[model samples]
Target chain A: MFEHLSIQLIMGQLLIGLINGSFYAMLSLGLAIIFGLMNVVNFAHGAQYMLGAFAAWFLLTTFGVSYWGALVIAPIMVAIFGLIMERLILRPIQHLDHLYSLLATYAAVLIIEGLMRQQFGSSGMPYAPPLRGGVNLGFMFLPWYRLWVVLFSLLVCIGTWMLIERTKLGAYLRAATEKPDIVEAFGINVPRMISLTYAFGVGLAGLSGVLAAPIYQVSPSMGSNLMIVIFAVVVIGGMGSIVGAVLTGYLIGVVEGLTKVFYPEAANLVIFVIMIIVLVLRPNGLTSGRGTST
Target chain B: MNSDANAAPLLQVKDLRAWYNESQALHGMNFDVRPGELVTLIGRNGAGKSTTLRSIMGIVRKRTGSICYEDEELIGKRTFQIARKGIAYCPEERAIFSLLNVGENLTLPPVLRQGGVPDSELLKQFPNLRERRKSRGTLLSGGEQQMLAIARILRTGSQFLLLDEPSEGLAPVVVKEIGQLILRLKAQGYTILLVEQNLQFARLVADRHIVIEHGAVVDTLSAEELVSDMGRVKNYLGV
Candidate 1:
């Protein structure tokens, strides 16, 4: 069984793992922030990711925009969509229990995915790689786009972590999560803060979708497929901990890749297995960072 | 300017009713606090002392009636909007962000008034907080957390402060220190509406006492009235 496992194969798979982990971290970070701030699970996050891909594709095909242009425009469009959703849909149900918001987002996912399918059809479409070349490492070949995804994603994850944990704006977001009323009583508009927070989280999801379009086919179901894995990452990382989500995302993605090398059969099931173990052992998640306040 | 006793009250609440979902908390509550006056709302656990403060701050959603601060009605306003109109609230739970450091928590509230107390001045007033500026809020003792909560609003330039049970669950010595802090705030000319179960602490600083019972104003007394009518305080508060 170990005979065919060469260094090149392992390194290649590790690269793939890193790319997947980058996406997991990005998506889960957004989820964690939204959950931390508003206590909403944001089930429509995947749909928003899909919308980002579609927006990029539309910019390229319809407006003759380049990958770079989509990179800038797509996330903003999706974020605006998220802002509308939050203000119109999520805000109304905000006073309800967390479960209702979760269900509402789940409903939003269905509506968004359905609309996309009707417009673009169910077939996957190819998105040309922006860099159009590969870099040959000592042991294996690395695609420029994949490397871009990894580096850019690392930058985003770190930047987002700093923004939330180390800045004055972040202080307001965290404080609002614990006690919105008190934060409001401090003369900070908490409802507006909450809306902007939701927009930011959804914007992150949109960015990930733009990054993912080149690697995976642009399709209606692409985000939904990846969403389950990202959810597993969020749970293992902990529901609302930013650092936990990022670290666990990369760790689990690599674990899944290694499993593919050692035992190909367990690759898909590996993340869920880890999630189950974490849930049983630490029900609050690996890092319980500042659980949401009612 | 601070000696405006003959002018309209700095803060006034009239027939303010509020509720949590369906259960009512403030039932036609009415009270007033003059500029530079330290007023305490004193009653037993369920007498709605806290509710009265929350209602005035617009923290409770189902509030009705009038809360006039500087003559602006606050009945339909959001808590943040009411806060911007020169009021701050320090709740009984302290409401400190467990994830934030002491200094961050101290300076968290955005300054609304031009002459809001600066962080340096607040740190001078709270020397312990200055020492523990980098410490996480959760690591602080109950006394320290209470200090952070109250001190947090000072820098926002809020002319009015609503403090709920600042001395609750603290050691007697800590309570004494808090009592002194209240006197210091009073001397600096900040109007205050304090909610407390501790009659002794109220007596130490408040110029007037408003007794609340079942979500309404049952009586009002000056420090002199309170001293003479200890039996009334004891009866209503059951302390």
Candidate 2:
């Protein structure tokens, strides 16, 4: 491996891998949380991410909002949208089979994607990076914005993990996920907790979108394009395992990045191949059955 | 025993009918638990004894008819609301969260009122749980899980308790311990409606027993009457 590749090339690919991993960690974490508590696959998650990016773009163009402002506001707007969707559409069909929610959220995806395409067209829109400098790390040049994204995403991911694993509210969530009716009998408002959980999960997707806007082209199809890979990430991580989702996300991202460096043709197909391997060897996922702990 | 015959009933269920989808689990359940009384609902398997407790907690959503707690209607109210009005439930399966530790399970239910037993007292009452405080619910034995199910609700300060099969599948010694615990709870003036298949255990701890068959109350017997008519009670239980 060292014979063909320079240190700079390896470092550069690794940095790119980490950046992609950050998005994967955030998006898959959202998916895992929603699926764990709500039992909904949330097929509309990709659309929600698109909506988050668009919300940021719209805020910047229409109201002269800064990148900082969009960061704070866009996720909140997406969360509100998630809250409404969960209450009006998902809540009614909650008693139905998992396929029902999958289809319903898929329908939402089509509707949202159609509207965004009509409004913004299929072309990718450019969002200016907030930070404009790069540092020479001796091995490779690193962008300050990329470093910020990776660090910030790590913070958010760790914060969320701690919130779910350590806090009192998290205890309620974990307990309710196991037995909602029993938790309700304990005087906890479980239905409300469920709705809020869905909202928070989408809010995470929205945050990921804002982070990705400056790196990737913000477009109506950006989220859907990335969604296939995200589903693969979730499967490899396990369906409802929170820690599995987060860890598998970053791992797959790095693996894909390394593949691009070593075997460029297999970069796109590597994660799916790993998914098949994981499915064959460990059907429940790598970190499942630990009982919600990482 | 604080059994005042003229005192208003704390909980009154009149003609309560519940369904699980298309199948009816409870045809019509009628019972009353007076304040400070330890009542038991005794019946054979599939006799809707568990369903009756579920109906009271509003866990069975398709229930019709009235469940009045402290003279307030509870049929249309949500489970949490019913709980907020000072009622707690311990399910048959001891549905403890396997993800949570014993301590977390113990304190999971919020304190609904000020009179709830503290964590220290609950640990003292079930000393086995004290040793397993850091262990997850999955790590607990059958008796420990049952103790956790009953112990968790004590912190809620709910005067009314709906316990389903607290002694189910436990050792005889553990069952006796549970019976003693129930007697202690009764002495503390907590109004409990227990669903038990073990008539001997029910007779030991309960002040009154309501015999259920096919979702309807067949007989109501005081502790004295239960002993006097043991043959009739055995017939109702099909033992």
Candidate 3:
């Protein structure tokens, strides 16, 4: 007798996996960009993501902001915070050893988290989904918000890729990764690019947070634990490569989902397990990766 | 003064002052890279040859000078903006994006020049790249990577190309290959500013040669004068 796990159950897991993958892809891609070219492990990424969720929650609660408004305003606001961090903090540490950047970001994460805790307290608060109700798939019930998360996140990811890979600004960004001085010589201001790149990258994480608010409990330390999994995803994807981040994010999420079906215990550890396999097989990743570090 | 049909210099540098941090490199230096001319900034190591090129490119952050590229003031402009106005730099480090393949390295920024040259032109010039088309830049041999770097800029077709010691650490045969490449670029009307210690390569490609000792232009001479005058050569380049 077959253990008849229905198509509905399978589809549900698939949807969950894809949604989780969307956030993973966004988070890890940003991590890859920052780590690859700048060579900084941005420990603040999770905190930044949490800040984004808080932005959405704050806008909604205090200003009666619509989901649409929070979607745009939250990311821009978080990006401004990111811009300040890059200009005031990250820029000064550009030339220091790798450890300095790590320490700097770690300090930033702790401080941001602490400040958020002070203001918001320790409890998690629920936010209503912007896109309400479930879409009826023949096999399963798919939530409209979850579907939006996958679709919108992919759109943003593609948009980012187009910006970085297809445009003149992207050329300079990729070029900056190769020869900053040569790019500088070409009369492209490298510092401004660095700042913009930081802001754009952090902005991606913020957008993910806004998207995540309805799904996740909004709290100060929401970003804290999620970062560990994303780091593993980044490593598995290869550091600093955008495509790799996206791919690994989805693949690992699916694998984790499948693992939950087969063996529940392994589900939580699946990403780290994949990281081990990748380290042994290809230190890089499935793709060659753009100019960002691998 | 800008390049003119009647009487202007192609590029004019007046009191070009530059520094790294507080340590000044170019001290009131003056020079010109005439239209369609190949000029050499010849000097010993730390003689500011490279600094001169960087300063002209507007890459030097702490720089004060009148660098006229055609009619635009290059002093205050940003680096890529300067490049958009028709100037490119090939650093001494041979700063190729090792992660990219040979083909990508060639075509990332299309030639700014209006010659309508395709990447095929680059392949024709350096057949080696075609041979290593799929190879990662890091996988290339020293000579191959150098050729790729130079070929990359040529594809861009920028009016002015600044090449910093393309022959540094290259074999004699590779140096000859580079000399031929530069000559080919010059023939196509690419204005080149070459910084070099390879006297032989400089002699082959340069129409006018100038020496920098301690960041100031100690002497400037035509190629003919350089061939004949031994005093400046012996004093500055020690050759």
Among the numbered candidates, top lDDT falls to 2
DockQ comparisons of all candidates to the true complex: 0.66, 0.81, 0.38
Best model number under TM-score:
2
TM-score of chain B of 1: 0.96
Ten consecutive residues with minimal summed lDDT in candidate 2 chain B?
B1-10
CA lDDT, every model vs. true structure: 0.88, 0.91, 0.81
What local lDDT does model 3 show for residue B128? Answer: 86
What docking tier does model 2 reach? high
Once fitted onto the true fold, the runs of candidate 3 whose alpha carbons sit more than 4 angstroms away are A1-11, A135-140, A280-294, B1-37, B44-48, B58-78, B81-86, B98-160, B167-191, B212-221, B229-239
Top DockQ prediction, candidate number = 2
lDDT of 3 by residue, B1-239 (tens): 12233546678888899999899998988888778888899998998989888888767868997989887788877777787777888888777776566676667665555653578777887888899887777788888888887777765557788899999998999889889988888887778899989887888888888889888888888888877986768678766
For model 1, which pairs clash?
none
The lDDT, on a scale of 0 to 1, for candidate 3 is 0.81
lDDT of 2 by residue, A73-167 (tens): 99999999999999989999999999999999999999999999998899999999999998999999999999999999999999999999999
User: Which one wins by TM-score: 1 or 2?
Assistant: 2
TM-score (0 to 1) of chain B for each candidate: 0.96, 0.97, 0.93
Model 2, position A247, has a per-residue lDDT of 91
- Fnat of candidate 1, please? 0.82
Per-residue lDDT tens digits for candidate 1, residues A1-294, read 689899998998888899999999999999999998899998999999988888888899999898999988999999999999999999998989999999999999999899989988999888899997888898998989999999999999999988877889988887887878889999999999988989999999999999998888999998899889988898898888888899998998899988999998999998999889999999878886445321
For the candidates in turn, chain A alone yields TM-scores of 0.97, 0.98, 0.95
